[model samples]
Target: MSSTQKPVSSEDALGQKYDRCLADLLVKSGVGFGAGVVASVILFRRKTWPIALSTGFGAGAAYADCDRSFNPARIPGTRILPKAEAPASK
Candidate 1:
């Protein structure tokens, strides 16, 4: 006989998906910051404040884009889970 397991609830699925997206955003932001700092240093060495400022703005824009794209629903309390309210055993 064939058997099929029930799929996860929508809430649980969405929570997992959002967690992954948040992690990806954080990693990307770190990379973006590092790239921005390197570019800014190069511009500074060239004695160009305008270029450095523009690079910084670009980095900010990238971060903003990630924030808005991944955080559309604004999941509340997704970042922290209290220890007292732990799930009980059946």
Candidate 2:
């Protein structure tokens, strides 16, 4: 018998990972920058550090998410159960 699915190459896997990381970085960093801008304008008297700080936080969060995606075992509250086996015939 033959399997129907195409085998995935290492390059394809790497490409997929890179795509995920890039998307996460863009989205997270954008949100963080927006938040920083708001905080800086409202609370910090238009300081530049808040924007930088929040952007860094967002980038860091993206890094954590990408790391978790690459290493699922690092995720919190995960459980791995054993498979069941059939009984032997007499």
Sum up the clashes in candidate 1: 0
lDDT of each: 0.63, 0.92
What clash count does candidate 2 reach? Answer: 0
List ranges where model 1 is wrong by over 4 Å.
1-5, 46-90
What overall lDDT, based on C-alpha atoms, would model 1 receive against the true structure?
0.63
**lDDT score, candidate 2:** 0.92
lDDT of 2 at 21: 99
Number of colliding residue pairs in each model: 0, 0
lDDT of 2 by residue, 1-90 (tens): 996999899999989998999999999999999999999999999999999999999999999999988888789996554455545559
Q: Give the TM-score of candidate 2.
A: 0.74
List CA RMSD, all candidates: 10.4, 5.2
The best candidate in terms of lDDT = 2
